[model samples]
Target: MLHHQAIITDIKAIIAQSQEKAIRTIDHQRTLMYWAIGERIFREEQQGKDRADYGQHLTAYIAQALEPELGSGFSKRQVELMRQFYRTFPIANTLYSQLSWSQYKLLLRLDSHDQRTFYMAETVKNNWTVRQLERQIYTNLYERLLVSNDKESVLAVAQNEQLPSDAKQIIKDPMFLEFLGFRRESAFYEKDLETAIITHLQEFLLELGNGFSFVARQKRIHIEGDDFFVDLVFYNRLLQCFVIIEIKTAKLTHQDLGQLQMYVNYYDRVEKLPHENATIGILLCADKNDAVVRYSLPAGQKQIVASQYKLYLPTEQQLLAELNKELYSFEKGE
Candidate 1:
């Protein structure tokens, strides 16, 4: 009986694997079909550039003839999208097999070539679902990362051209915690925020950036007969260091920085292996004054970072403004 059950399990596994493979094959074929159609449409439009209305008339004619026979995939709007997809990609080799038609549709909406490239590389690297890709795009993950790192460096890291050497490369200054389901107007304690983060740990790690795995919550330490609890402990594989996070429900102060620094010191001296890099301390707070953060930490300090957490995602305008401010600061050598 046990042998029969084992055989059944093996067969189920094989069936599931084949099903997934079939789905992937279908998705890839659909992508190729769309690309081919788009390429043909673009070629036809080029041949009729002399006639301004010819391109419009051609699309309408094709859609009118195909929609009823081929379903709404060939609708006028979708046909336009296909044309745009060809024009945007230009090279057939650039389209990745891992990305589905839905993912491509979302990618088409991005206007910047760099942004599209970054998202493409990230989506493939992380094996992000269409929904995950959409969330990252809407949350302005690219813009947020740009706030700390230069464009070339950011793109290089995303494309796997280089591993991140600095914590700032992977970490964002104002991290979004909208997934925690916290209300913007509501008051919450540090413990409440910490509990929420622990409950929604996976989402927190996604927002925290790449290579992070949860280690502990309220991790206790002892020094000279005194005990203290660190709010959160994480290990980043890429950076090869322990990330010690301290949550602050109020605006950041110099005292908060000091306490986090102490935890970082303890982790480095006690918990960290000699082969690992220095522990990074992140002060996740509700609000922070840049000047306070700067002066609070020693000059040329890289280990401690104070990042603000928002209950809601910022608007495009707000992210743009933040990016601009960071750029200005960088230019001024701040």
Candidate 2:
């Protein structure tokens, strides 16, 4: 009976594999066809540019001619996207096999080659779905990571060429929790904020950067007679340690830093295994007092980090200005 069941399962698996292969083949063919059409259009445009100006209505005319006989898939907008796709990915051989048409469309929406290359490398490395790619772009993942480092290091990190050796390299400041649907103007408790984060845990993890998985929430720890509850606990496989996180809905203070430091020391001494790295404690506050935290911690402290959280995405202009400022500082060795 076991042998027969195993055979049946194998047959089902084979059938599923064949179906996926067929789908992939169809998609590959579709992508090639689109690229070919775009190339043809581009060549024709170049030839006609000096003799006459047919640039504006070329795709429109092509769409009108093709759609009636072929279908709605070759509409004006799609054709234009195809043209852009060819222009952006000029060399067909450089196209990634893992990327689908939908993923390519999202990549093309980005403004710069640097952003496109970073997302392309990340999408393949992480196997990000189209939805995941879109979310990362919307949250400005590139810019967030770019803030703490120079452009070269940022791009290198995105390309997976340089793995971050420290939390400072990976932990983005002023994390955007806008997806949690909290209202900044309204009154809310720390518990309420933690509950919202746990409720939307996956989005929160993505915001936290990669390799982090939830471990516990409101984790109780008893030292002597006193009790403490950590708002969130996560483990990062890449960092090879437990990450303790505490939530504060108000501005951060020296007390919060001291408390988080104590948590880090507790975890390192009591909970951390012999082989694992020391525990990392993060204090998430509504307002980050950077200078105070710097003064509170000893020089070159790596275990505890404090970061600000926002209920809404920060303004792009503000982030860009900060990124430029940071880049300048980095260049000047500040």
Model 2 quality (TM-score) = 0.87
- What would you estimate as the lDDT of candidate 2? 0.84
Q: How many pairs collide in each candidate, listed in order? A: 0, 0
Predict model 1's lDDT versus the native: 0.90
Q: Which segments of candidate 1 are over 4 A away from where they belong?
A: 1-7
Against the reference, the lDDT scores of all candidates come to 0.90, 0.84
Q: lDDT score, residue 213, model 1?
A: 98
User: In candidate 1, what are the lDDT values of residues 219-327, reduced to their tens digit?
Assistant: 9898999999999999999899999999998999999999999999988898899899999999999899999998888998889998998898778788778767877
lDDT of 2 by residue, 25-63 (tens): 788778888888888888878877552457448888999
Candidate No. with top TM-score: 1
Model 1 residue pairs with clashes: none
